[model samples]
Target: MCEIFSKILQVPINHIKPIDYVPAAAAVNRPYDCHLSNNQLINLGININCIGFEDWWKNYLNN
Candidate 1:
């Protein structure tokens, strides 16, 4: 997933960092958070390879 995001962001894969958070898996719900959009990716200099991005982007969305 980091590889995919890194590619879209035009950044080195090693530069991608994951955010660690405890999920409310039992009862209490976690607070809602904003999601990343393609526009934001572009602003950050993403590539949008126009071939794999559509399918690859979904891989991280589930996380």
Candidate 2:
């Protein structure tokens, strides 16, 4: 999912950052109850565009 999202967004895999909730999820101290898996978090970030959004939207809408 992360790979597909990255390709769709034209962003490199390494450039994608984890969502802010990741640390909070990890700090829960419950191994069995996972808030979000790594791949899921990465996919979320890719979907949300943690760093780039305004520029992409501008260019996308203008074009």
Candidate 3:
């Protein structure tokens, strides 16, 4: 997951922390703002329609 985020956001793995939160979508005009797109989520095998972000993430990580 860290690798995927690093690739999409063009940031180093060290820059990504487990406590970070990124909206599923965000305003791209903001300086240094980043978000995860629906397509990217789908490509990662995560259903974009899935609700409960925190719960889903916990389950994903546990799996």
Sort the candidates on lDDT, descending order.
1, 3, 2
Query: In model 1, which runs have C-alpha deviations exceeding 4 angstroms?
Result: 15-63
Clashing pairs in 2: none
| Residue 26 miss distance in model 3 (angstroms) | 14
Per-residue error at 41 for model 2, in Å? 32
Candidate 3 lDDT by residue in tens digits, 1-63: 666545545678875568566676853556576776688777899966756655556567568
How much is the lDDT of residue 46 in candidate 3?
Answer: 90
Model 2 C-alpha lDDT per residue in residues 1-63, reported as the tens digit of each score: 676556556778996676766665567564785664468767666553344655555467557
Summing lDDT over every window of 10 consecutive residues in candidate 2, give the lowest-scoring window: 47-56
How many backbone clashes are present in model 1?
Answer: 0
How many clashes (backbone N, Cα, C below 3 Å) per candidate? Answer: 0, 0, 0
TM-score of each: 0.24, 0.23, 0.23
Cα displacement (angstroms), candidate 2, residue 53, comes to: 22
Task: Give lDDT per model, in order.
Answer: 0.66, 0.62, 0.64
Q: Better model by TM-score, 1 or 3?
A: 1
TM-score of 1: 0.24
